[model samples]
Target: MEWYDKKTYIEVYPPKEFSFYECIAFLSRSSQEVLHQIKDGSIYKLLKIEDSLVLCRIRYEENAIKVDFPDRQPEKEGCSLVAKFIWEWFDLEADLKEFYQLASNDGILKGIAKSYSGLRIMCIPDLFEALVWAVLGQQINLTFAYTLKKRFVERFGESLMFAGETYWVFPTYEKIASLQVDDLRELQFTVRKAEYIIGIAEEMVSGNLSKEKLLQKRDFNEVKKSLVSIRGIGDWTANYVMMKCLHDTSSLPIADVGLHNALKNILGLERKPSIEEIKEYAANWSGWEAYATFYLWRSLYDEAI
Candidate 1:
């Protein structure tokens, strides 16, 4: 409802405690997506709303974020939707007081949390995009996963040129659902992965799987159960979607390698902890497991955990 003027740029007021640079640091880790850019203390991305694509350039100033559309300004309704998307993408509504206070008491989390203050769990807001990301990252390392995504997006996703740069939008489920395994196999995606991705895309396009439907579940366990029922989606993938897309603060991907490595590095263990050990350690973060996982992952890059 704020910043409704279509003739001018839309401005969003983040929480006073928010840090755009910290969030930019997190986002800048991977530049292969072709959809996002973090440079010169500003963030840029192409967002597809309904049928039209809009390019958004966001810069932080004082206590607010300035959002500008260089090519075309969206209608008031579209502007509102984009504003909400940005808010949710950064988890902007969160008040980290309780999480920070709890972290202060945690031996491992205390230092990591303090070092990465104002770092929220940045999320992939689209359900389809999030699910596809989970499926892509499934048996691969982060670097290879980015390679596959870059190829996939460049090949299938729509693009627009602006100022000698090409910006892309993640391919819609409709486009993916119509493809055969061979179509993706040509792009280096394993046959099994292609099937799994197409299956999930078909589900989303057919009205069977959706963020709105998933959110109807009563609790995290219900959401996890529903997601894991799909092909190629396991407990880890389900928890990932819940935390990153559904905004479940307590979601934990206990089997994530990044999480394991972060824990192993921070705890000074000779080997990665067993699932049982992870469970024991998880008791310290009952209600804030997602934030703990995020900060711990950040430790891998920032080395402050």
Candidate 2:
């Protein structure tokens, strides 16, 4: 991520193929989103950099992402952290050329990839957020998933009121680590999910699970295995975390409902694909399964799975 600190703000330059519009379309899909607010085509997010809670106004302009702090700037290191956050949030480091080339001849992704050429995987930079989201979305529809997320964030997250609306920061594991299962269940979380969330937070607090640790195990299989070893994370969730949080390009959630629906619609199948069928279709995807799944998910909607 190439960036420059301009005293009051920092500017990030993305690759030529990066499409801010497409990412915005995906971000705008859920009106219930609380962690970030999109208004007037600019995204406002609250991030806690070390000790300072920084509010940044992010917009793509002139092929660079302009991040402006509404109140005041932080230390130089904080500026770089914010830039890195934005970089990972957009998954800007990925070379899409390889993925595009692989999709060009595929039976499933050729057209879908072209249709959403510039759309990057809207990644969740926080490991906890990504893992919790996967849990919340299990066996639920996207709208309800967003509903759950909004409720959860509003209940436990921090916020700052700007203009008229509020900008939220996702709840910190440090905060949630002190919570009990009953607390989350009161917010409409299932008992299982509440336990999983609390347990995951506790694991992080105990230094048992951290994104840094996962990144150290660069082997895709090793990372996936480590994630799946966690009580709440299954193969689907592990693959999801790998793709969204660890930035593993080969991770694929073949059982994802959105992927199945997208494939059914794209292939004109009367019914959704079986697990075996999806594997057969995905065989050639190899190292680009994450991108392929993302583009296919885009075909279902601008929802940005």
Which candidate leads in TM-score? 1
The parts of candidate 2 lying over 4 Å away from their true place are: 1-7, 302-305
Task: State model 1's lDDT.
Answer: 0.87
Question: Tens-digit lDDT track for model 2 on 154-272?
Answer: 88888877557677888889899999889988888899989988989989999989999988884988888888888889999999988998888899998898899889888999999
User: Against the unseen true structure, what C-alpha lDDT does each candidate score?
Assistant: 0.87, 0.87
Which portions of model 1 show Cα errors greater than 4 Å? Answer: 1-7, 303-305
Weakest lDDT window of 10 consecutive positions for candidate 2: 1-10
Question: Model 2 has how many clashing residue pairs?
Answer: 0
> After aligning candidate 2 to the native by TM-score, how far in Å is the CA of 19 from where it should be?
0.4
Compute each candidate's TM-score over C-alphas: 0.95, 0.94
